[model samples]
Target: MTGYTCTSCGEHHEELPFAYSAPAPAFWQDAPTDVLEPERCVISGEHYFLRGRLVLPVRDADQDFEWGVWVSVSKDNFFRAEELWDDPKRTDEPPYFGWLATELPGYEPGTLNLKTNLHTRPPGERPLIEVEPTGHPLAVEQRDGITLIRVQAVAELLRHP
Candidate 1:
């Protein structure tokens, strides 16, 4: 596949990045030092967060676009996830309600605080986040899927933003 020129950096990349990720929740930046953990699971006082993926189908491609993002869940749900962290049966757990904690770039009105359902996968995979049906651009893309050209556009937008 041909790579596109980055609008921001004006550099040519060899391939488009099908996946983007936020290392931690947006709140993590302002979290107090004492309430942090050295793992993917974060418990900032009463708020709980877990890293997961929000996937969108690529209409004309064989692969899907994925965002490695964070979701804030309740304390009880957080503990339940931790308890099944390594269990293959973890996928049996029902979806957990959460709020999107990552501010995904390139979306109007921002992407934080969107309602989501975190569905547990098997032991080795991150939970799959299903954005609630809405008219937001991100949600629309998730529901209707996007073309490869759109993927390229997103790659360009995020490359140096």
Candidate 2:
């Protein structure tokens, strides 16, 4: 595959990054230092968050684009997920309602606090985040799909931003 020139760094990357990730939820990032936890994927206590992937089909490519983001879930759901964390049957669990907790770049209205459903997968896979059906650009892209040009634009934006 051909590489892309990173506008931000003024360097050429060997390949476009098909997935972008947030180390933690925006809330956790902005929280008081005392409330921060060391865990990268799950945050417990007053607020609960779980990292998941929001996948969007690339209309002109064979692979999908993924946003490795976090979503805020209820305490109960958080605990339940923890209990089933290593269970292969965890995939049978019902999807949990959550608020999108990562603010993705390149969207005008912003990608924070959007309604979502976190669907658990098997033991080794991250939960899949399903954005609620809406007129939001991200949601539309999730439902309809994006072209290779759009994916390249996103790669450039995320790489530079």
Candidate 3:
């Protein structure tokens, strides 16, 4: 259930079914056990569930896009980090750290982590970040430093992020 190749109808689909791209990747956290990276949304092939810490779908909040799902680690390390970037360095050009403010240095707070999956249970099953309040303010803030998050619970968690 994972054959891809359709940057918008190139044709080669297989099991596509992913939909979560907005503003939800500050470093989400929920590591207990994961490893299932299976992306496939080049143009609606769908199939996106990367594991490591990806709960994408945040057309608001702070920002969450560019490979995700990795905290406990599942989604098969999100397809083994894209099969190790599918060799050839996948064109290389990542690892940067210049912009993105709101206190994004080491990302502190136990080490880069942000999460959301509200079904109703902000007590502690996870998903209630907002600086840990259990009140789902949809956190991630800094202001002067830049980092600012809180766009209506990630725009309603992007419908189903």
RMSD in Å for candidate 3, one decimal? 18.0
Arranged by lDDT with the best first, the candidates are: 1, 2, 3
Weakest 10 consecutive residues of candidate 2 by summed lDDT:
31-40
Model 1 has an lDDT value of 0.86
Q: List TM-score per model, in order.
A: 0.89, 0.87, 0.19
Q: How accurate is candidate 3 locally (lDDT)?
A: 0.29
Off by over 4 Å in 1: 6-11, 30-39
lDDT of 1 by residue, 17-131 (tens): 8999887788875545425443355654678898888999999988999999999999999999989999999999999999999999889989999999999999878899999
Ranking by TM-score: 1, 2, 3
Per-candidate Cα lDDT values, in order, are 0.86, 0.85, 0.29
Off by over 4 Å in 2: 5-12, 29-44
Model 1 deviation from native, Cα RMSD in Å = 2.1
lDDT per residue as tens, model 2, 94-125? 99999999999999799999999999999878
Cα displacement (Å) at residue 76, model 2 = 0.5
Per-candidate clashes, comma-separated? 0, 0, 37
